[model samples]
Target: MFHISYTVEGTWRLLKRQGWSWQQPARRAIERDDSAVEVWKKETWPRVRAVRRSATPGSSLRMKPDSR
Candidate 1:
């Protein structure tokens, strides 16, 4: 067992010398469901695309600048 006080830089150097490195955990939740995502892609996406494509004449899904 070793007990020593070190500044931030000194601590970082010590960790490097001891074969340690920084790491980041995954950004997503572990409980996320895969089957639900596939169902949405296959079932919901086509309906959404159809609605967007069925716009009226001279009108669009995008926001247009008001000419008034």
Candidate 2:
């Protein structure tokens, strides 16, 4: 076990010298579902793109009103 007194960079270098490589830990949410994400990408994304492409130039959906 490495001591906390060592700097992060120094510890990384020491590990590398001993033939160990650093790996990033996954930061995914605990409740995330891969199938649900895939379904959204395949189904919902295409419908959203179609609506955006079919919108007219003068339509309210395509225009942002002045904030001032």
Candidate 3:
């Protein structure tokens, strides 16, 4: 049985030579409706905000001042 082994660089170079370009998929859908999104946000954003506020009581993400 024979198998080919490739280093990371070798595989990347092979893909590059094949015309592959690295990219991330778009976060938003191309066919999304902006007005519908705005309406959903207006109705649901308050509840989302409330959940976070209720989950963490008196806790802050900010760092404490230096006490030195």
Among these predictions, the greatest TM-score belongs to 3
lDDT of 3 by residue, 3-45 (tens): 9889999999999999997888769778999999898899978
Q: What is the C-alpha lDDT of each candidate?
A: 0.84, 0.83, 0.83
Q: Candidate 3 versus the native: TM-score?
A: 0.36
Q: TM-score of every model?
A: 0.33, 0.34, 0.36
Q: How accurate is candidate 1 locally (lDDT)?
A: 0.84
Better of 1 and 3 by lDDT: 1
lDDT, candidate 3, residue 29?
79
Displacement of residue 21 (Cα, Å) in model 1 is 0.6
Q: Which lDDT value does model 2 have at 44? A: 91
Q: Which pairs clash in the backbone of model 1?
A: none
List ranges where model 1 is wrong by over 4 Å: 1-3, 27-68
Please state the error at residue 55 of candidate 1 in Å: 53
Better of 1 and 3 by TM-score: 3
lDDT digits (tens) for residues 1-68 of candidate 1: 48867999999999999999997875877887999989999999888885445555785458887889
What does candidate 2's lDDT look like per residue over 1-68, in tens digits?
67457788998999999999977867988889999999999999988884445555664575787699
Give the residue spans of candidate 2 off by over 4 A: 1-26, 50-68
Model 2, residue 65: displacement in angstroms? Answer: 27
Name the lDDT value of residue 63 in candidate 2.
72
